[model samples]
Target: MYGIDVITLVSYDQVQHTDEGMLSLSYWTIVGAYTVRGEKNDTGTMVDAVLYDIPSRKMLFRAPGTSRIKGSSTLVNLSEQLRTDSLNGFHLAADNLVTNLQLELDRFRKKVKAMPESYAIEHQPGYTGGGSLEARYALTLLVIGGFALWSSRRKEGFRDKF
Candidate 1:
């Protein structure tokens, strides 16, 4: 009942640690020495959205988005930091996916207009397709109608005078 024409499927794929590095700090004094160590993690996420024709089961297009996040965390909080970074990466990638989807939609519209035979375009029952008249065309029609009305009135005035 919703009149759905196309279906979109989204997935998050290719998630991995794109980069890793070691972080270390050391301080030495006359009495003793202290050292700290940590790990730097870089996570990457890819989001893909595919649009398909429900009836034909044909793929219209695929839009892909990617994001990378780098952060340093102590060994005790490594897992928590990585989880936060992964969530952030997905959010950023999803945002980019939306932008890509819009661009793909515009491209698809232009393609359909350029080559109408490739796909079928239809409107649901009780829905009528319409086009708008340009401002100049409407203004010209209004001027012509007004002049015709004025001329008719002027001619009637001359007939009454005679």
Candidate 2:
């Protein structure tokens, strides 16, 4: 089959973070237009195609532009060529996308590795509930004192006297 040879792929992009927990793996496809000229024709119509991929960055399908060649010997067979060229573009796009994703994941891994496994808490209860009675009594007294102050402030409208 004789058809146009056009190749295209998605462009480079940054690692996107979305409001949802998961990040977005969005992609935009690029298409090249070519004129499928026959052995005797001076010019051929332009053909364009856009391909789509799944979330896993695998090609799902493609949507091609209109074809404007209808003749016995015009060599206007474009479906096969479109498929071939589009596949090539898809591979290139996938490779680039994977490289970028790997770089991003590496950064994340490094950050996680640098983080501390356990963080220290300034004040916490004992593991076996064996806290000192004096500390517990102090906490209760503090709570009661705070409540009294809060009640007094509420009764006075928390404002200066006129």
Candidate 3:
């Protein structure tokens, strides 16, 4: 098993489907059919995610996300279209869940900072805190330092020549 300190449980909270009846396509021409129409389907998905400490079984935070998808499909392809739309709705809901989870995590961190006594936090031995400088940032600083040195040397050379 993979080593994990916390576990996240995701569940589908709600699912809704609506049939909007036939939608007319007036602009398109059909060879055999006099009128072209499609059935409108709408699907809504809601997902909930809960974070918990594996060892202590303490609830950390909860996040919820929702999504809605509406599409029109011919009678022949209605089933397949509905299935694809349902999957898309779930995907969108999951994306929203990730965004909400990040926001909740930030709020949780603030809460922990504010009320340190309420939660027990511990770090493993040999744990060190540090800041990381990105490679692009470091390269930019080096280039700036090199440019400044070159400018100063150029000025010095000009003064010596005069």
Candidate 4:
């Protein structure tokens, strides 16, 4: 909505192994399983999608989906896994992409809305220019650490009293 007219699915990459149609599921399950054990996971499907925001000229999100099914020692099992994986991957990637993009957009909106209204550069009031900001920050950290250590020691005796 940020002056965006066209939102395009720039690229859709689906791994060749995903089974989209059960039409060939039976054929492949039998004929394809002969060498399933000999091969290593040639059946699983994976899809990578990139969304392009045309108005902003930015790539919004990339979602990748793949089969989560486990246990495939034989060709039959592997074929089944692949069939499931193909569908699983597409769904997982799409769902993840949408959720991730929503979170990202929310974060972006919060940041933009809360941006400081004005900006000005000015020197620190009591700075004699003896050391840089980095040095001062380091010293501040050391002081805080020392104080914490001192306070923690005081509580050591208090715990024994209870």
Candidate ranking (lDDT, best to worst): 3, 1, 4, 2
**Count of backbone clashes for each model?**
0, 0, 0, 0
Best by lDDT: 3
Which segments of candidate 4 are over 4 A away from where they belong? 1-6, 16-73, 115-162
Per-candidate TM-score against the hidden true structure: 0.62, 0.27, 0.61, 0.38
Evaluated at residue 21, the lDDT of candidate 3 is: 58
Q: For model 2, how does the per-residue alpha-carbon lDDT over 63-139 read when each residue is reduced to its tens digit?
A: 23222222211123344544444444455455544565566557645654676452222333344444546778999
Predicted candidate 3 versus true structure: per-residue lDDT over 83-130, tens digit per residue: 898889998999999999999999999999999998787765654645
lDDT of 1 at 21: 41
Instruction: Name model 3 segments beyond 4 Å from true.
Output: 1-5, 13-35, 54-57, 123-162
Clash pairs for candidate 2: none
Candidates 3 and 4 compared by TM-score, better number: 3
On TM-score, the leading prediction is 1
Superpose all Cα atoms of candidate 3 onto the true structure and report the RMSD in Å to 1 decimal.
Answer: 12.2
Whole-model Cα lDDT of every candidate shown, in order? 0.78, 0.40, 0.79, 0.55
Pairwise TM-score winner, candidates 2 and 3: 3
Backbone clashes in model 3, listed as residue pairs: none
